[model samples]
Target: MSSPQSPQSPQPSQQPKQGIACLGVLGVVALVVILLVVINRGGGGSSDDADASPSPYVPSSAPYTPPGDPYTPTTDPYASGDPYSSPSPEPSPYTSGTCLNGTLPDSTTAQSVSGVEEVSCSASDAHYKVIETVPLSTDLSRCNGNPRTQYAFSYRYTLNGATINSYVYCLVGLGSYAR
Candidate 1:
């Protein structure tokens, strides 16, 4: 009788299993490649048919005007370069109507006020222009700051021993708290 065989390691059977596993991985890789190719080619509208230069689509009724921005207030108006380099774009904060007091004093006309204290008009707290004339009733409204003073024109001199155009007073600064 043949001698009883000794228990053996599983190496012989493992070889076939490893071969099958490698084949299975290769099969999956090939399947994925095939699927990707099919999807890329199968889209109903191919990119080849697209226009070379796509234009912005606009409605037919009217000529397209790029939308104007709804007004938004900034913390500082003179935030840009030299203040005198370009004219400031005067801002309108009030939406409902013009403020009381009345519109900006006629730039063409010279006006004056008396017993008024002088202000820097360029100070931190006084950084705005007359966008609207505050109504007298609304002059002290939340939007108004401490009624800053500015000299539209101030001169003290005598021509023929008389003072002319000696002084003019105007309020400056945007008092729009609602903004």
Candidate 2:
């Protein structure tokens, strides 16, 4: 038969459990002390050292100033008036009765011609002679039905999307320069 145990004192079987609990508490206390020592060692300096030094960055309060006026307007030489003076105070070399030395396409299909220059009517190199002048038109119909006119030449000048000067010349073939 077993005897009853008192509440103030533990039984022999429970004594081992209390000893194990005390060892667990001592292990937790030791771990906490070790963790605190490692954290303090990893810190580079004390808090007092951080407070003694001044910060490196400082802000400016004065307004900024630029060196020169970068937004000034520039001057365009051809903006004031008509840069292409068609009918000048003096007579133009390309006017009627004058001659031009240049190549004309064999096809009478009417096309744009370049590399033509003014020449004297009597010159041997003169290919075509101007018979009439038509202003602001390159239309072949302007020279149509004219017996002496074999081809039409036009001139147009523009500045800044605006037509400055335009004209057309009625040409007559000279010698073997037909077509």
Question: How would you encode candidate 1's per-residue C-alpha lDDT over 1-179 as one tens digit per residue?
Answer: 89999998767988999999999999999999988888777654467756466789988798766556536554456677576786433322222222223233324344443432322444434333433333322222323343453313222434566543232223443454112
Candidate models: Cα lDDT each? 0.44, 0.76
Pairs with steric clashes in candidate 2:
none
**Where is the poorest 10-residue window by lDDT in model 1?**
91-100
Where does model 1 exceed 4 Å of error? 1-9, 43-179
- CA-only RMSD, every prediction: 19.8, 19.4
Candidate 2 lDDT over residue span 1-179, tens digit each: 89998678656978899999999999999999988888678654567875696768765876676667656546664777776765453245377788999886654456777888888889999999999988777566787767788877776666667766667778989989875
Off by over 4 Å in 2: 1-93, 106-110
Clash counts for all predictions:
8, 0
